[model samples]
Target chain A: METEGIYDVQAIRAQFPILSRKVKGKDLVYLDNAATAQKPLSVIDALVHYYSHYNANIHRGLHTLADEATAAYEASRVAVKEFVGASSPDEIIFTKGTTDSINLVAYSWGKSFLQEGDEIIISSLEHHANIVPWQMIAAEKKAILRVIPISDDGILDMEAFKSMLGPKTKFVSVVHVSNALGIINPVEEIIRLAHQHNAVVLIDGAQSSVHLDIDVQTLGCDFYAFSGHKIYGPTGVGVLYGRRDLLESMPPYQGGGEMIKEVRFEYTTYNELPFKFEAGTPNIADVIALKAGIDFIKSIGKHAIRKHEEQLLEYATAKLKDIAGLRIIGDVKNKVSVISFVIDGVHPQDLAILLDNQGIAVRTGHHCTQPLMHRLGIVGTTRASFAAYNTLDEVELLIQALNKSLKMLL
Target chain B: MNNHRTIKNIEQELIDDFSLFETWEEKYEYLIDLGKKLAPLDPAFKTEEYKIKGCQSSVWIHSFAKDGFVYFEGDSDAIIVRGLVGLMITVMNGQPAKEIVEAPLEFINTIGLSSHLAQTRSNGLRAMIKQMKMDAGAWQVNAENKTVE
Candidate 1:
């Protein structure tokens, strides 16, 4: 796999066909990594391999095809467990995506532990996926939901967060990395603080899971949820890693065939551990493909990738900050590869349109974190997020495009 | 223009209004002016209750049924959003449920709003129009039921 320049940035670009296609008759500069990372050939090939060769439902059959599929599926789970440094594969349950995984915890955990006046703590930097489900659950259970405020730098205001934690705080679900601001909260500290109050913690790892190495045991988070798509894996597959005891204590999310051990009209028994939560047929191809994504990440090595990304962020920030009327939002020092900014004169939408005309793809909006958007006192911002595949040349092109777009708009 | 006065000639009038411009520039100019003619949104109407969810801009949409037609008043904190609402109301307002429901959305293409809008905003418009159409359909059904009674 480490053939001379085989994984070289330019060589890697050749594998993804989407990158080759011209947008507005110019080379595509996909700067929307926080939204979804572009899939590599290995991940794409894994999906094709699964569908083309071993396309069968797992766990229920003893036939050769079923056996092959089941092995592949379980292998992926083991990979995920290793990838996230979870203790057991039994702790990993697959779902639709990060939103679904968070919903699972909100409904199941909230139902089991929460009651009238019980408090759940979240941060100001949470995505709507992390925010709304908790809100719904809190509404249903008559629980008080508290928000931990953020500093102007976009990192979690740790002092405020510490103050917010108390005995009534049943659980704290917070974003490990904010999708909008790209700020990585100190989750280990958050989990520790929450635990001091006897509160369980769930980390919405949608953004961080891709960029950072995670160890649930070390972090001591009760549950962790992230989507595969954000990690260059296929969409429609996500993983929720809950401590075995907590997972066992909670009720199943959805009722379906695979989740049940035995089902009669009068009574039904859920299967043990992971399958009990993974209702219905899972996204088999995507789940299998996720292993390839994990492998790809491992092959590149997290340290090298993180170092590369930090350089990109530094370069992009310096260049963008230099541009007149460009105010970079969420200028926290501890951000991942995302940069959210608002131009003084041009609307983010208008800037985005002009950028699109130049074949530069960047996210412009509240980024599904409307409450956070409100807190920031802006309707939206233009976000340019980076990934390992993105090169310095692309960054130069982006700045050039911004210059041209500014000339056109301002 | 005289025939445009009658209810039977409404479609013809709309077509004629649409045909007034051979070029897109003239059509956009007409649409923008139409927006200008819209009575300014009451400042009080910008309350949180009137705000549409899932939009990047702060948009307030207020609708009421009058003379069996749904009339909408909208404003937004963002200029482009107001411009979008102006375009929406121009195509949609005054037309009864059946005609409005069946109106070709192709005018969005003609005005180039679809091409110009961000993907999320474009989807947001679809969601808003869907909600409006569904409400209108339900209203028409209720009216028909009342007539039968």
Candidate 2:
């Protein structure tokens, strides 16, 4: 349990094979961790192990391979459950990703529970995945979608959020961390305030799950959803943790094989807890491999990982700030390892292309937060996000690349 | 000599210019330079209606038929994409409508620019090319209709 060498980023970097690869004849400097973290060797090996050994349909198979597959899949659920500090594995439903999880709640729960003129609250910092689902549900149900605004520094306006919540506020969904700005919202406070109004709160933890230690129990959020890929797991799999009673109350998200308790000509009874939301055969290998991703995080303690990332963030921020006419989008105190900035004369896409040509990977766009970009009064920003494996050296490379590219551009 | 400059000549010139750079970085710098030197489109023509679809960045390309040749005014929010627009314009602008429609534009591939550019940028470039061709095709049809009239 001793995380002695967890902060050794060089050791961590070796675990990701892609880190050694060359892009455009130079060393690959990946800074797009907020989009998707590169999988460690353990996670990759876990995937190959599952597919090579026990590739079979999970749950209801009496055969040995099926049993193995089912065990591994369910074990991943337990790993996710423990990772997020959820009370039980049954509370965790395997989802496609954060988008699928949000859509599941929006359609199944929102359609059943939301009434006309009811209010659903979301923050301006939310990714489109978090925003569009509520918007669709609101339009369909004739409910109102209220947005909590953010300040110039990208922190959510808590006072505005509190004023928005009332007797009519039926649901409140917010992002735990802003993917675009990297600002960590005050979700615990938001959850507490929403619960006071008897509103169900769903936290979009897509960007936070990798960087921060999460405890659904402590946070007291009704629903917490995040993507596996963002946390160094495979692409198709994700987790949606909901309160047991709340999950039981909502109807089945999809009615198919695994989600059914009994199928009758008249009506079919739904399965219990998590299975009620999961339909048909899931991403068996990916789900099984997700446990390895979680284990990878635990092996190198979250605290240690956070420390390393904070160092990288600080180093990168200072280096980037030193460059004249380079304006960072969000300068919030509580933020993850994401830095979004706009140069005075260079377009984000151009910067991205130039950096990419130098074997440096960075995301340049609205980061799927177009409304947030509009609010910030910019078309897009060039974002460099770090993972636990990222190092101070890579940060230096990014700064060097940016400086070189900007000089050529300006 | 300038009056006889064809779309093919311009594409060949671009290819020659690009071939001068040994490294991708140098080529990119040259591209940015090209983008910087591009004549700015009139603000009035940079409207959404004139915007080219399929581009990640906002690219406006306004085409008009003048003296039997198609003239294109182009701009983009992204400098690299604007440079790409400038490249496209350099090849197609002031070319006869028939020649514009018929031009192979193999120079993009010949210069290895197609392979060098990102998929989205290539797609956007193709979209711009398609739009220009469509504009030329329309003008060609209009000319034929006038002759019939």
Candidate 3:
């Protein structure tokens, strides 16, 4: 299980400058990777390079800097197109983040496609981003929002999901991985079942893209969305991979210059596929920098990174399971490198404060899934999410810190 | 409820007590103990109606006035936040409406736990302080109106 020699985790750690910094007079053992990853130097350098050298407005400028900037931005689209295995660059739409991407699909595609009394099925595992947009659109359209319930262990009740699908089922949007529990949903099966009912599926890959190999065509989901920041890239940038025909059919999310081809006093012709969805002056610097993140992942390979993280998850789970009062939530076979747990008689916030005092950073509370917390019958949990850069030593530190924090709390 | 000890006196006492603890470990351990020893709030007042909106952990604050002195009782699901609530009650409880309204509560910073109660995190400590002051202010206005009548 030791991946130390082949994975070169220290070398991976070296690429991230923030990894070496002290948080509270101690070396920062950042276990909040599921929240947002620390950027590698390549991603940072790409951001700096764009602003310093080719800082100009994109797609419209005739100047040299504009041409350079535009090319880099579009080149990033191709990188993302390849990253998600989209059929064409046109299917890869740049968005603000996963939330924004979901909103775009809901507002644009949902408005266009959803009918009265149609059902939009989402799961209990989804973050608010996947849940709320569908609810809003459903409310507006007088459509129904059906929830795919989870089992006691946080796995989606696939049989219940299958039963939930019917003639009224128009859309199936769910998280590929639970942000709160790190339980990987059976998205492929969900997609297949929903497709049988002719339901368009949107996978919220915000948590999965970092760990799994994504292939949009193979998965056959109509839309896939993930945030760049979660994948060691810059924030304010994400990708929404829609089927080309679906993108062409949907209305523009907003009325802006980039989204239009030609505007007249009476009528406006919208821009083609991806640009139609990209409404405003995009996060050009971050989008271009996102390409560097993709390249970094490609350089190291996700298999190697996943192997290293899986080892960390396994090690941490065993150590955490040894703690008497600690109970791990949703430790299914298909989970990623995230561990969510609650300890008896220890408030998560109190544990977080004490752990943070020892320079161990972990996420506390509902983790943006309040309903999931309600289902689990707890107010919140303390979650330690791993990344490619995290190590076994850090996991041991977390265990030691948890033990010390628990002593003070109990 | 100590009539001789003003809010300022309680503040000074808390500062002196917190000063004894050099590290956050001792400080937090003391806080957890303070939280546990804190009296359980009336179960009826622990509902959403008394709940403070800002905290990640649920906090409920209930205040009432008797004999022109405002009394406050609060509780939180999180022990650390409950400790903070206990501190607030110690300083503000059984004070005259005006005294409660005008209490300068800067001892939290001196105790080195200000970040836990920061307004940015929307921690219950800040919101509870605001609500307690507002309650005191309302009580003061009501008392003044009664005198005028």
Candidate 4:
């Protein structure tokens, strides 16, 4: 219980019961936060509460359970809207996850605005969710998909990005933080430059949402996308924050029960901003539970969490560098708490298994960013991403496990 | 002596050998050692053509038949996977192509590698097993055709 500087990490860790669990006869040192964070008891209870008390269809239901469910569901929307600093609750459109959120924008907006030969710019650091959706749309629209290259260190070549932005650049989709490398991209400069070309900008905040303070309004990007599961919330729920004007202008993402204003044999008009995109019954339990995740973040405050995580990151970076034959990719100053590294003579997959035996869960593979892996000139790197709950002691445990694992591997 | 052994005998031998190790660490160490000892595939066959799909690491498994018996030469960039490949080769190697194809590979369970390989993350090992069976099946088809001819 290192209760230093008003940031009680041990207290925070206590809230998540999974932290006390074990794997392979050892205490679970879960480091795979970048994949999906473990939910807090608060978030888990929200799901349980929803199912137990008021489990019913939302929006159109006239019954008491429906009213309670709808209230809780919409309350989450307002929470998300406030959480991301969107202009209004209408700006927050709930979807499956970041992938679904990005697809909503790419499918709806790209189909309407993209012309042949139009250039859509995406950085090299983007997750597959950010890249693939735009690529699909660009291909269908006969638009060119221009990629912003990265330096050997995995930092985005910002100057090259500036030169690429022009009247032809119809869209600029980039990640706030690289999930593969954890390098925070120069998205602020990117947004300003893309706006000069009148190109729409989308920030894939999937990796950044839980870590970075996200003020979508301050970001001035046309759209921001993130997943709830990454932020200690439930899976199958994500947010797409589009500017109200932009959201209203774009067509509905999916046409179904909730998305429709009226339906007749003649014609059917679509619903308003958020609901227009939220088609069908939506993930009722998860969406309501997502507010608890948001509240958990709000309770601790992002600044305190960020400060604590930075400590863990600094400690990890310094210690991981001490390991012989270990190379930290994208070891930049400005980054999140993720440490993606490759050790000589040891495959990342091998490290993943040996670490699991030691009860240390880490991510090993391309992390759904194969293009980035290709650029890095490696098969894959083992990543150990930290959450706010992660402590310096855990980082030391990681080092110890790595040393033990490497003994067998090397 | 090698020609006298059946696939069942080989599988039982593997289970017995693995039963000697009481701990997961010892089992993994054994697997890693076996992987290192497994015959390397020809560099030419190490290309995408022979590479096992769905593996986290690159695993190239080349199969051939000699005197109606199937032999497998496999290697993996990841030692654990290579070790799994080694285990597969141990069970099926030197068996008749028809027998190799028909072998249930129950030793994976008996040896306690089933739970370790079951994790979707280690899908490479599962994919490797499927590939071994498939390669042996191809040789079985060829042997059957030769009999028909």
Candidate 5:
């Protein structure tokens, strides 16, 4: 990936088939990137290629197609390992998506390590995927759940986090980037501090992995999880990276074929590092296409993509702040590409509808982070998230749509 | 607005009559007609300042108290939004403050609107209603304060 500002927005836009169409008679200006990114032709073609050429189950069979399938499947793990700068390919385990990955950790790690009266610390910035699983496990395990508070700027208080990390703290899970606020948390420092207290840390990288350069090994976090769809890959496939020793210490999340080493009548042995975790038949086609997504990101260059996104964020933030009665939420100093705001008199749902009629797509609601909504004293927000492919022209279209809606409503 | 129950009863009565329509298409036509019978909102009342945040369509709702009852008038840029406002106003407007506050909103299920709406839209509707109720509660408290004075 070159850092020489090779961001051809028009060329990038052409790669996504969905971008050419019209929604409600206007050109589709999709600003809902944080919800799910539009896939490029490379990722789509990879899916078609897998189904058309070698569509067979991986790792178990001896035939030619099986060998091809196994090679592609294993290659994705290698790609993900390299993408996140993991220590080994063995650390990358495949699952349905980020939600499933976090749930697996909660059940396997929380169930195994968290005892009665233990503590699990999370911050107010978590998506429900990171919160509810821990809540359910905490309830079942009789462990006390603690929450690190956040300031009005949507930044987590490290002092509060340090205070929360006592001897009773067994685990700490935090979002690397807040889905609702666009706040880029100092996860490396959080992980380092948590390690000082001997507590395992899990960083939810669903939003961060796409825009940020992640080196999980250097971060020293125990576990990291992310989804492929958010990174321009197909949905329903995700990666979970854990320390080799920690993964070996935990139990398997599910029981099924391919995960067993040897199943005897009396006893059963689990399979290797990743296979031990991927129990059933994986999302075969999607896992293969995920490698293509990684290739796309690498070809474009993470540094260049990050710079493009930062420019979009700055431009959109300035424009949106100009709208009357529109108060932007989570004014954190460090952020990714998400912008959440609320109009005083206009319901976000209404705003979304009006925007949709003009073929502008934006996410409106609590964004699956209801507890954060309560903390912010809002029912929901109108969220416009950017991607590498988004251009200044598209941002102008969004603003125009918003202006028209406000005029019609007011 | 001491006549919310009466309005609800009228809506139920209308639905009962429309239920006789043989097909869903016909039933839907009749239901929409029933919605048209509710009082029309004024054009001036339609403003961004009154737009309810969180709906897919642009909707503006404002209320004015007349004879101790809050009379709500709302307009929307979309037809479905207008219909939703009509449904809510049927159960909310023209009711005694106490009754309006305590009224069971379970009838929303019978109307099939709650189930038909997506979860996000449903939540927005709930928030709008909650805001209306809070306004009504404030009025009720003011009434008590005036009596005590």
Candidate 6:
């Protein structure tokens, strides 16, 4: 439990009640953390507390419940701002999830500023959520979409990315950590390079926000996006952190009750920063509960969590490497606790089914990175992503299950 | 009753075969074994033209009609899905076009496959069945045209 300095994974695992559940007569070994992490009891309690105690619409009435809900929701904004080291809470806009956040930028910023022959740069390591929005905007505006290729080992081609950046490059979006490959991209360097070309950078932090420590000012990124569920928070809530200046300059993403200052038959004025992007009533309960998740991470400390996950990744990598015919994808020097692999002559789906029967949950498919899979010349890979709660023993169980399943398949 | 007896007999055989396994694990192993024994499809027929949509995994199904009987050959990138395809082909292939179209495939439920498979896999299975039925209908029309000629 206490392997390293001040970190006890057993204590962390105890906070998450779902870790104790059994599936199919076997103890559940949840390894699908990248898809969405299991909620901690504290986060769940926060959700229940909100609905039971203060179930009212946010930013509306002068009633006590409404006031309580509004305060909690705004507190959550401050928590998120501190979590990612944003300059102010006003910079954090709550949306549905990471996909919704990216779509907001693509429509609001891209539609208003981008023009014909303008270029938007994204890496090959991006999930479809990060890719499709840019593609849609590019198609509409006739802006060219350029991709920074990745090496066979899943590291981005930095030289190619630098060459791709030019005066025409208006925007650059890259994944901070690949969901499928677990490769931690050098986003700071990417932002610096993109800035040299006078291009704004958006770091897709869907995978990194939970695993790594993020300081947006230090990174100097124009925008950062991540989902709450990827951390220990509830779904239907995410944060889109944009520079205050950029957000103010951009038009409103959606026109609704919360996003408008005033509306008339002749004209309409949008709300201030953050509210300009958040159109509707928003996922109030989930957003309020997200503070608990942020608090949960802060209490555990990001350094400790990162250390634990790094150990898991190293141990799993070594164990999986010993298996015959099993090839680990994306063996980069810097990565989170995610392992994607494929076995010769065994389809990833079949392997996933066998693992599920043994009560080990993993994701198998393109992982919404179909272009990445195509680039790697693989149909798909079975991905086992770990959270702070996952133990080395669980990794052992995974190894044993893979061995048994491989023997059966062979 | 004899008009569709072959399809019914094959479905019953599948149900009995699946019933041999006491646990889902053993059943899945059996399915994987069956998938390995699936008749290989022609490389040329593995194109996007023959690929079945609505499947999580890439699945290609090819069929042809000869002497009023429709034969199907199917393959999937996922082994478990391929096994499901093999099970379907075992029951419906080499049957009359009318029988292939009309057979309800009640054996999927009878064998407890419908309950066992995940929602996406179940949808994929239904898509395969629908595509096979469409292929049979098209082939039946072509056969009718030949008779007219």
* lDDT, candidate 2, B1-149, per-residue tens: 45689988888898898888788877777777778889999999889888886435888889898778888989988888888888888889888999999999999787666754636553377778888899899999998898899
| Cα lDDT, model 3, residue B1 | 56
* Candidates 3 and 6, the one with greater lDDT: 3
Mind giving the per-residue lDDT tens digits that candidate 2 earns over A237-285?
9889999999999988887889998999999998888899999988888
Q: Comparing 3 and 4 by DockQ, which wins?
A: 4
Clashing pairs in 6: none
Which docking band does candidate 2 fall into? medium
Superior by DockQ: candidate 4 or candidate 5: 4
Off by over 4 Å in 3: A1-5, B1-3, B120-122
Models 1 onward score TM values of 0.83, 0.97, 0.97, 0.98, 0.79, 0.96
Encode model 6's per-residue lDDT on A173-223: one tens digit a residue: 999999999999999999999999999999999999999989999999999
Predicted model with the maximum DockQ: 4
Error of 2 at A284 (Å): 0.7
Instruction: Give per-residue CA lDDT, model 6, range B1-149, as digits (tens).
Output: 34555988888888888888798867877778788899889999999999986435878999988878999999987788888888888888888898888888888887765753635552378888889999998998899899999
lDDT of 4 by residue, A1-410 (tens): 22336787899999999999989899999999999999999999999999999999998889999999999999999999999999899999999999999999999999999999999999887788988998899989999999999999998888899899888999999999999888888788899989999999999999999999889878899999999999999999999999999899999877789999999989999999789998899999999999999999988888888888889999999999999999999999999999999998999988988998999999999998999999989998999999989988889999999998888876
**Candidate 5 Cα deviation (angstroms), residue B29:** 21
Looking at model 1, the pairs that clash are none
Give the distance in Å from residue B144's predicted Cα in candidate 4 to where it truly belongs: 2.2
Report lDDT (CA) for all predictions. 0.82, 0.89, 0.91, 0.90, 0.83, 0.90
Model 1: residues >4 Å from true position, as ranges? A1-7, A264-266, B1-54, B58-76, B79-107, B111-113, B116-149
lDDT of 1 by residue, B15-102 (tens): 5667666754354445445544556799888787777664555667776666677767887544445556776766567657666666
Candidate 6 global lDDT = 0.90
